[model samples]
Target chain A: MERGGVTVRVLGIDPGLTRCGIGVVEGIVGRPLTLVDVNVLRTSASVPIAQRLVTIERGIDAWLDEYSPDAVAVERVFARSDSSTIMGTAQASGIALVAAARRGLPVATYTPSEVKAAVSGSGRADKAQVGAMVTRILRLDAPPKPADAADALALAVTHVWRGGARARIDAAVAAGRTP
Target chain B: MERGGVTVRVLGIDPGLTRCGIGVVEGIVGRPLTLVDVNVLRTSASVPIAQRLVTIERGIDAWLDEYSPDAVAVERVFARSDSSTIMGTAQASGIALVAAARRGLPVATYTPSEVKAAVSGSGRADKAQVGAMVTRILRLDAPPKPADAADALALAVTHVWRGGARARIDAAVAAGRTP
Candidate 1:
């Protein structure tokens, strides 16, 4: 699951009840990243709610088993968005987190703005811009369709760049030093 | 997990990130419910968020394995409550749902008002009234501690009373008729 001497394999998840996207990437921070796989798992609305959650869990488990990434990256859900869609998103995120945690993988979360800024150099970058950047960074022939896949890849790239071992150690030290 | 000739074992969940409550009840409609078990599973905020989710998942799995309930009942999450607590609650609910779904058990969600009404005959009943009714219904010496346990038991009672086999059939028919 390694690319170079200092490579890190990352699995990023853009969680959604209807379409949960997963992307795996491998590379060091400064080097060009390789796209291992990209997929958008979907659960139909017609299924019972519990069964839908089961579908999401199975999809996530399959990805984790297949990729065995060094770290799992997830989109941080904000409670401020008081919408039904956000509730489903939060639930999907929880399922993904549990899957990664059960495997004892490090899990990091980044906000949407952080993901966009990391991928496109602008927090305010639109979807198309982020897609372009993801395609360029992964050296893909074209942007991943449906946007969710691209967002997942962006999340992986962001984690690999911003939340590596050195960054986590620094964060821990900063928290300790603050107290 | 059986009580009488007509036995219904229900595992009710009051989902929360920090203090998720689980109560198992065995009984029949129009009969005094038996309290099988009650517990609160806690995950502290100081721990890593992913680990917290893993703890929750493990707690739920343990309950399901031990209780072997016929059905799982959960408190439904509302998006209107724009608070951090609701976010964690939703996440925990998701984990519980997935655990039950993986076991092929039926999952039902009751709103707070519905639970109160089913337990106390009043939708606007306060926590004390609900707790008192829970004690009376189960013939307990005293109310379960921390309030969450009572709420979980109430949810299980509500599901047994309102969402039995007939109600589930009706729901399926309604869903099928919807289009």
Candidate 2:
């Protein structure tokens, strides 16, 4: 639909300080077709934890700039035991949003459970299951490594299918309604 | 000094809820040169904020994979106005640390004052002064768009100089030991 029938691209981000996973998918909703890029970003502890987050942010920005995504989808936070860990999670998420917004791109966010449900058909889907589903869905030659990458792909797909009024539809489906 | 003579690459992060600024620099402490990347990450009010954090974390991870930074650095939290904001900041910081540690990277931290002095030659430097100095020192043609990106770069360069025992050195410097 955009620029002579090039399918709109959706960039999915799986946030974290050390290992951030990103997946780029092409196509439209109700049929998220292919996974273009699946990769993990890494950092060394010697640089300081906060620095690593910035390092990750820079990488994501570069990716965004290169691709010019139509929309961005990210996975939301999950509960963790440590207060410090949660703060890092929130900060990373903020960075991703700013990156997309600065480019005047719309953004969507999905919860861990919701992403799991959409991809795995179960809210409690584990990392491995989600990875398998992502691989199968994308028809990749190999499963994405570093777990987070697969999760990122799922978030992007979830946003396309289930974000916005799709949530309402899903809720209705749960209630056994067609509308 | 690297096997491939690849300039030592370090990624610095400033993790925040409202924004996370990230920067990457290559070279050793005193001879630091090149700014590979600088960017801001963002999210929104509508999405459950917690889930947003996770997406940020994953995004950072993907960046790390692409860049393969030698080390990661992050800014230390100083103070904030709101209690909820502080809680969120703390949680985000934790996630940043988790990313670094999970990757077996030795994480480091630098306080705001330390980062300011490193870049501006003033411990209590303001945002503009710090931003200006970062642009000057890094030879950036344009002032980094968002304040957070500049701050993240400062944190990274600071970590390069005095992240480990630099605090003690800074205190000594403050005592007029060295100019």
Q: Each model's RMSD to truth, in Å?
A: 3.2, 12.7
TM-scores, in order shown?
A: 0.93, 0.52
**Chain B, TM-score, each prediction?**
0.91, 0.83
lDDT of 2 at B40: 78
In model 1, which runs have C-alpha deviations exceeding 4 angstroms?
Answer: A1-5, A165-167, A170-179, B1-5, B165-167, B174-179
> How much is B110 displaced in model 2, in angstroms?
7.7
Candidate 2: regions farther than 4 A off: A1-6, A78-84, A164-179, B1-87, B90-179
Task: Give the deviation of candidate 1 from the true structure as CA RMSD.
Answer: 3.2
Worst 10 residues of 1 chain B by lDDT: B170-179
The clash number for model 2 is 67
- Indicate the worst ten consecutive residues by lDDT in candidate 2 chain B: B78-87
Model 1 residue pairs with clashes = none
Per-candidate clashes come to 0, 67
